[model samples]
Target: MPRPARTTPSRRALLGSAAVLSLALGGLAACSTSEETQAAAQSTAGGSSTYPLTLTSPFGETTLEEKPEKVAVVSSVDLDIALSLGVVPVISPLYGEAELDPWETTALEGLGESDLTTYDSTDGVDYEAIAAAAPDVILATSGWTLDEDYEQLSKIAPIVSFQGADGLTGMTWAERTAEAGKALDLAAKAQEVVDGVAAKFEAAAAAHPEFAGRTYTYAVIHPEQITYESYDGSDTSFFERLGFTLPAAASRFSAGNQAVSRENVDVLDADVLLVGYPFGDEGLLTRSALESDALFQQVPAVAGKHYAVVDDLVASPLAYPTPLSEVWVLDQLVPVLATAVAGS
Candidate 1:
């Protein structure tokens, strides 16, 4: 759901030179524009806006004394929520080297490329780079912000930590958006976005009565091992919201994920199975391998071909639940799931 905070060394090593250059250049740009932007942001932050907004997280409570204009977001999903609320963050984390994902490319229309600064948080929260932005408030709801990181960020501005079980991954997309709205003094707008997604789910269920009473599970196909990791919570919640039930066998694991070996693939058996794979040919090969496995073939979903293979790009937002991403996901995912159900 939320991006993991502890990025592996290989991932950190993959940071492109261009992203580094952008961060370097963005810092320089932020410095040159700080005085003017900060002045304007302060005026908005203090004027007519809700102040002393307090949000409680696992770490403790953080109260924003003013409405924030210069907001900095460490979590990648928060940026999307900010944009949807018409508040462009002064600084946001980059999704790897790319400034935006495919869905974001369309969602962020009319926003200037230069309006936002981007940084890499794969290794950890970039306190120094974030401090450079000089924000009035920091949104770290979706990032891996530890207690130590929270303490450091507090020195920069009023910061809202993740509002769920853990720092990085607990909050549902709706919860995170609502929290962001409260912090930004746009509670009504946030509710509207949440309502919109709820309505979409209702529409999907109404359109496909067959989806009702069906049991389904979404699993990740590990590239290295011939195993499936079934995820609960947000991933299952998506289906549950649409009137599907998660099988009890898969629901007992409250840790969000339950790993099942290939020989024990029945743990993932359900009326429908949605498999996610790494992007490209590797994903296809993995899907093929799973399909060809005799043990996997014994599962009802596999036997009936009542499964859909989703790529990483499409799976990320669905796996983690965000307002904009949820809407985008429904548009692209419903048809696939519907097809799987029809076959089943």
Candidate 2:
């Protein structure tokens, strides 16, 4: 039997302030707050009841005695969330590809190139580099932060790492937005951002009733290996929220993604297919090869031309969903789907 259909719940209802903080602080021991830390927390806590916030992550609980002015983000989504919440970090690391994604480019607009420092963190977090940025608080909420990395970063500033069992991926975009809001003391604004994007999804669904009840799958083509990896509904939560459904054939995989050889390409039978590739000529060539293959052509989405090719920049934001990235994806994704399912 196929896996049961996944349910998308409201992050706010599921992770209330107390629950979220408790889950985050579950494994860590309580420690005494220093005088300097207490002073900073009191000053930055502003007038809100949630001030002097204590954020729990995989590493431990980090209590912020005050608002963090010079913030540094290890993950792109964290950085984007910070910017969306009107808090620009002193340093924001690149998301694997070694450059800013399209959403980041738009978010960083109006600020000088030097205003936000950028660096590569593909291998691991650079302790010295991030320490040099001198952030009052470090946001590693959506990155691959190991315990040792957290230990070192903590020495520089209070660090907030990923929460829940799935780490970064466990938290929905809404949850991440809410967490960022709480951390930065912009809870109201964060809710506004989440509601706005949700409104956009509702509008898109209403505009394109054709999208309802349709199944879709997103895949990354690896032409050289004659294999393509299919992503789970969690990875395409935004699409699912916009009224699309995931095919059971593609959703049964345990890893939320599965690699299928060319011989099994028929498994990816969906009303719409969203293909992604790395940026540059190599990715283009790979996508082209997959598009031309006789095996892939046999797939329903390919046979009917109901597919869209998304490059790294466009796909990055979706991979790490944020308020800004959600808006960006809807703006680009809705039209593509509309066109793909037009005559069907």
Candidate 3:
């Protein structure tokens, strides 16, 4: 049963940290020199410098008068992608602030650039702050969709909302990055970024052939019996991106573009399972249920102790697709998966 929607201090604090924590644990990573190396080696788009660029955004076609300089990215995910591409916009949302979020401090320490200004979303966005940055174009995403605030942002610059594009709609992190690349006129570069990550997964898979035939399943088991397991092909998820296969039973539940959950968690049967929970709260419920369930204990992964506790924000399709989330995935998840696969 879904937990009652009660707002306690603890609940509110957790809910607030959830977004920040997810940014840390999910796939947000600074653009590494290694990734840059791979990108440099990839085939380029040739000599297309500055021209009238028309980008297909979620809202509509955004025609750039001449290679967008002084851009404003309203989404943290978009901020990460833009930063990764080495193009810092005039204005971007702060991931976490110094007083409120220490994770942001550590995350940006080695990233080498820090000219961004924070926009407090608690009240409406400060249009004057954004205008002060002198952005000619604004890139807004999910939260701003249909919100009156976007209209105010639009008055300052041509705001292209990402909540509407088919390419970005419910896309995985990889797909989202590709879409962002298109917006930046870095389509070829985006393709290379994905190709490079996929290649790493392939190498890890090759090193750990045992996982080759292994079937994996994922879920978020919240307190009070809120269990969500993947239900389809689009649910292949980052685990699938990292070379795991979904069980046949769960294959039929694929939502095509989004991650859909099963009504009954008991239907989740696979060789391996990944459970997620919030950060500060003890993962007592998830741990206890998995440990106590006979069917869960009998799974191949459980018998072999192959099951892992993944951060929901890291694994969730909604959070991880942004450039911000990818960094987290690489740092926290990839290294562990690479080692596990290598040894297994």
Candidate 4:
């Protein structure tokens, strides 16, 4: 479904939109706050919030009776957003073995958080654990089940949920960040964080003038079919931010999903073909099927080796593109993209 033009959200309405699976499908942790975190949470000038701000989610409206000093985040995307704004939540998704994106881990360390009171979200929201942290607000902006769990969660504190977001795909990174900022009472810092990441993309784009006006398609190489990410959705803003464009034909589908069979693989042809794989052998196995297909082999970019196949870890930026992920993958992606566009 097409998204409506955004209005400045009222006390009960929301202003922004969601990210991808890395956040929605990835690990969920509920961390704790500390004195160092309090110090780090100080916003730059113009980023303060007055108390009793009312916020809205799809489930219901609630007023943040005060600046939320202790937040509980349901997704890593929101965790990244909170960390970027320099506020440490009291509860977040459990990182487990995969841990957090380097940017976030580093941020946590910088904030003097040596340990986290983590909980596995795979079983679902650990309301007991969240309550244990005694949070003032919950950041479920990118949560898949925020609707069903909103009431239960609100019993603990106000929920700043994502509004107008597509199911699962949630809000764009920018939208998520802005919403998190508004909820945290650090709107100014949120924009500052967004602007900082934009400048990074701008620098990458400026350094590589060839990327300007170039056409590209980003997709995941699944086994039976190929799913394309939209330039307007699925964090294709990562490419657009890097001075690339997604051709109308290359866009193939919308709402950040919609699979195309190998027979129709020609739609992906562009100046640069970027495909990502799952973390393990599954991605390689699927990639083999895609590359072996006669139709895929004939695509100009693929035929000329003007493409880049990245592992899932490196592709999270494409999926979510949060302030943390964006910075983490910039150096890694630019060189790969540069080679693809070299088109030798």
Candidate 5:
């Protein structure tokens, strides 16, 4: 995912470009006056927070000696949040780099930043590689093995582990953005990012009033496993932000987050059935594979051609919808879903 190495642009320069993207892309005409106006507005807005910012994690409190300069993020969520704030990390997790959605590439190119250093962390933390990067801060909002490695990582730089007090759930998009803001001393810019995305969601929901009160269900159909995983339906779900809700009948399956057998696949019934394939597992679960299954064929939504199957690459971002991924995905997904709602 890393392009060729070039001189790393300073964060301040990237910050200006990011601000320009936000305003110019947000329905305003591009002009010198408009660009200068945003720059002037952000001079006061972007630096409102004071540092030696002290942030807490389950492991311990890590205090920034001053605002962090070189950021190293370890998860896609953290990477997206940092990019939203215009800081291209010195390093990020390797899997995180592989999962760079298109929106993230746009953000990186917008900042004129590239060739990020990343280490494979599939098994555990690569403490040596991370230490070698010598980051001003490590944004581990969704990192792994932190309980064991937090103290070790702290030796390299202050680790901003997930804001989740329990050290399990990690931070939401807003929380991560806000926390990263505090560490970077860009609290006002962070809030603007949060508010800006919230406005986009609101606008989407307004545009798709028909999405309101729609009943839906989500699952991963594993042909190899021969089962369907039902994600717990939530009233306050990401889909809910776009005015969709899980079906009441689906609530029974949601409680267990269980794998419904092919025989019992009728339980996935809903006005809209949103399906996902595991990245490699897509080969196992083909359209014909489902058609050959007699019982799976009877599922109401599928029978009615009212199901939308999202490719895993596209669905990966929604696994933890950050500010960057959600906007692009919504634009692409809504039309397909609206068609499903219309029953062809």
Candidate 6:
């Protein structure tokens, strides 16, 4: 028999829409005093409460009401995190190639979305759609923040923007996840999920001895022949958390070089090639996309068939916050790589 679907809370049942919107947008006109703000900030750490609570984010500080039910997530990753916590929001936008192309619907299966309004990040958000949903809390980042847009979103509800404190811009996915969780008073649960992923990664690493000595490269390739490789201590926080060894060839590039040209493909000289396939064919990397390309065909990985195509599931930045993503990676990607190495 198939496994039962996980129980989740309804968007409307999660929080009071009007009150949540007020707290998120800093529009608590009813309680404008500093004492009111402090009182509301004191209530949200991890339980169901009506009191307001303050949270420190990668961007700055924002206060949220306890057990916020209606959440509007700007990032799909944030959506996944909220879903994992059993809080389904009114509207959550999709991201990456998996989300945009082929109208990526599989990723959102069981998330309770059916013909909901979608927003384009490139041209800013769809205010009309957001207003129609009547969301109470809006979760986004300074990276995508526009002053006018922010002001407009604030008008609709309370908005939580993820920014880094001090020198920290919340660049890492883990930090951002933690910040969001804290804002919702879900820190312990988030940490537990993260720790579970770490444990699973350790087991997978132990089971695959071939991966021990091998250096691997993780690259995000675009149709334009530009490749963006992962770097240590960079924005690729999931990889960092999993403790995967990166290819030495990536060292030649700078820290922020998320995209690379065809000329740079030669520099990815690792024993194994792990390419992210968020768009197009899901198994492009494992197959022969590299061989078809004259520049990449010469790489030792392609020649030796040492490439592994990662699924769009765990391969996305959006899904990085969920333990389910970890299961998909270690259970699916690791064995595929092991088999490829053995055959090659």
Name the top TM-score candidate: 4
- Over 4 Å off, model 5: 1-45, 95-99, 120-123, 165-167, 223-236, 255-257, 279-285
Quote each prediction's TM-score. 0.77, 0.75, 0.69, 0.83, 0.79, 0.64
Alpha carbon lDDT at 16, candidate 4: 17
Q: After superposition, how far is residue 49 of candidate 5 from its true place, in Å?
A: 2.8
Best by lDDT: 4
- Candidate 2 per-residue lDDT over residues 77-105, each given as its tens digit: 67767767656666665423233445655
lDDT of 5 at 209: 89
TM-score of candidate 5 relative to the true fold:
0.79
Q: Model 3, 1-344: lDDT tens per residue?
A: 12211122111123333223212112222232233332343326322434565654544455566645556666555555555544555655432221212223333443443334555433435578678887766765433332555557656766545544343345555666665565555666666667766666676556656666667766665443434456564545556655577777675554432232333444455666666654324433545655677766665665566567675434442333445444446556755554444434
153 Cα displacement, candidate 3 (Å)? 2.5
Candidate 1 residue pairs in clash (backbone atoms < 3 Å):
none
- Model 1 residue 120 lDDT score: 66
* Full-model lDDT for every candidate: 0.63, 0.62, 0.50, 0.69, 0.64, 0.50
Report how far off residue 344 is in candidate 6 (Å).
Answer: 3.5
In the predicted model 2, the residue pairs found to clash are 24-56, 41-65, 41-66, 44-67
lDDT of residue 60 for candidate 3: 47
Which is the winner by TM-score between candidate 4 and candidate 5? 4
**lDDT score, candidate 1:** 0.63
How close to the true structure is residue 309 of candidate 3, measured as C-alpha lDDT? 66
Residue 276 of model 5, lDDT score:
66
Q: Is candidate 3 or candidate 4 better by lDDT?
A: 4
TM-score of 2: 0.75
> Where is model 2 more than 4 Å wrong at Cα?
1-49, 94-97, 110-114, 119-123, 223-233, 279-285
